[model samples]
Target: MPGCNNNSRLSAEEVQELKQICRYVRKMIINTVADAGCGHTGGSLSEVEILVGLYFRIMNIDPHNPSWQERDRFVLSKGHASPGYYSVLANRGYFYEGKLADFNAIDSMLQGHPCMVKTPGVDMSTGSLGQGLSAGIGMCLGRDKRGLDFKVYVLMGDGELQEGQIWEAAMYAGFHKLSGLIGIVDYNKVQLAGTVVETLDLEPLADKWKAFGWKVLECDGHDIGEVVDTIQKAKRMSESGPVVVIAKTIKGKGVSFMEGKFQWHAKAPSESERKLALEEIDSCVE
Candidate 1:
């Protein structure tokens, strides 16, 4: 959506474009799950702005050359959010939009989880949760070893943080000063079962990252401008150590009926529900 000036600074028009893309991407996520009859609905919807903000404005990526060595790398640690990830990748021209209909099918490149071998733009195979950060840390370290310059971004679910491995990876990143690594927590608070706090609390979350030796930042994940600005801030300050942005987001962001509802976590909409969902997205003010 943003101009290819290749930096995070957003013009008014670019901000508007990113917002429009968010709406488009959200609708795509809804339709994708509705078509498939099953998918991670709520989290996918929740992550539209975060993914779009990175893909459209923040990261230096090339959809045409998905594996270009010089391109930036992005890892979707919370792989159940593949609907959002695939929607953005398809819309960004990593693959055909029509292919989204085949999502999660046995032979489709778009799978329930990201597979770097199957998906053109996916940088890592993720879905096990709490492991993406570890892979991302390796990627960042690899860049140093190869004398290459590129940033690694890992998107993890807030609930996924409950996995002990996440903290272990955080500790490694901090101890090694992996400044090129950027960690994004989709802090929607709602998980598959219940609210994150009600399940396993992550209060004092920012402090946890700071204590791990990271420069922690927080933002409204639904706001594209804030997402871009905060990510750019992370990049600018990353030399201090790795950075983590705890993005506060709504569980089901763009759709009124699904917003903040944990039951919608992995449910597809009925035909009537799909109609209502698309209408709701269309009704949004661009």
Candidate 2:
């Protein structure tokens, strides 16, 4: 672990190091997208910090024991954001970092979306929208049945909330009082076609989750301290239902030209654009 200090817990310095890791993760994402010739860059970049916070700071996971009974489960509901997820997994020692160079190439383990069968650390194969929460709920229910203490965390794109199946899962989780489950919404507000408001507004989103009987929390996704603190708080809250963390974030956060732009949602950068994006992300490293 290049950034790992001796502590088992994430210290202030470690959090800072993780932030640097996120920067490199963003750079790797930019390079991969550039090579892939097509990808969901905006959403991927927007969720990088949150993924870093989870994989490095929050989640209790083991790369060596991926299927360990006590390991927490993470489901990437926004599967198109796999670039961020894969980058974090690689940095966390899930696989060889060199394999990242072959991202999206023919015969590569990294497809455009994450595949659990191909990827070492992926818990579930996901791409279809609105299904991850259900899978997470199943895991939580299974753990509860087995009397296990593990938790399940799922990340969903804000636009994915438009899918009716998500609400069904939410209703079930709340009704069953699945307290072991946590769902984080990446509220970047930009989807593939356009801004979420233009497609299907998820405004009053947190309230909807609360109404569904979840303990809801909101935070700035880019703030590592806030991300860690909120998730820890959510874990401690006494709730007979699921928890939802609404993470407000900017699409293409680190790159000025791509920030808040819908066009970058599913488009790859050209070589020139990739050079600029890499330089911009690199400037944030230190």
Candidate 3:
């Protein structure tokens, strides 16, 4: 809430710009994933709007000085979604856009999962599911110790919530009253193997978080305006402990063939598939 309370809503032009930016990020994801020949496609596509909303409009970060003392911290709990994370960081000027071409290469900075030591603007090195919230809590505590008001935002996958460590971290954050911390769950329904319902249902998800003393918020994950608005409300809740936004999104968002399918969860598009995906994303630009 440190830098989020004032002018939180986006103007019409800003909303359009954010949408275009997200589209571009999606394009980057498609290209990078296909070119790399191995990457998580569905989850990365699903989280485009959430990542764009945060990096471009929500979080107070300095791309040039990624390690600035006062910068807000972000933890990508669903680290397999590194394509989306890396694309957003590149578009945000954290690194040169050309570097994206080397994603997932033998010795590239943009590896399969996000690494703070390897990539700029990545606050936490996360690949294992459910550990990001714990890391985010630690970040908040460190900022508190330093008397810094910077907030911490953690992005997670709905399937990752099946991990017990996630629940432990949630309880810890809630009990400690980490008001400056926010958790976002990309509820895209599908996971690596199959749908979350078939794998392990987390029904009544909002209620579960509320039971843990977190302020639960819900929004359409792909809608930048709604996501930003929900984040604004989370920022406005004064000292009400930690907040979590359950964002409903579609896996493989922008591509007709991949949307809602689990096969794209970690497979790269073929040449034809990549062309089709790019065409669909280009249609969304205006």
What are the models' TM-scores?
0.97, 0.94, 0.96
- Ten contiguous residues minimizing lDDT sum, candidate 2: 1-10
> lDDT of model 3 at residue 254?
90
User: Which residue pairs show collisions in model 2?
Assistant: none
Give stretches of model 1 more than 4 Å off: 1-5
Return the candidate ranking by lDDT, descending. Answer: 1, 3, 2
Give the range where candidate 3 is weakest over 10 consecutive residues by summed lDDT: 1-10
Residue range 1-286, candidate 2, lDDT tens digits? 1222122445789778878888889998898788778778999999988888888877787787677778878999999888888888998899987787777777789987889889988998899999999999888878878988877889999988999999999999887778878899999988888899999998788889988889899999998778877876776662456899999999999999999999898888999999999989888754
Backbone collision count in every prediction? Answer: 0, 0, 0
Poorly placed runs, candidate 2 (over 4 Å): 1-11
Residue-by-residue lDDT tens digits, candidate 3, 165-278: 999999998887787889999999998899999999999999999898899999999889999988768866625689999999999999989999999999999999999889
Whichever of 2 and 3 has more lDDT, that candidate is 3
Q: After superposition, how far is residue 264 of candidate 3 from its true place, in Å?
A: 0.4
Q: Model 1 reaches what TM-score against the true structure?
A: 0.97
Which scores better on TM-score, 1 or 3?
Answer: 1
Q: What does the lDDT read for residue 88 in candidate 2?
A: 86
Better of 1 and 2 by TM-score: 1
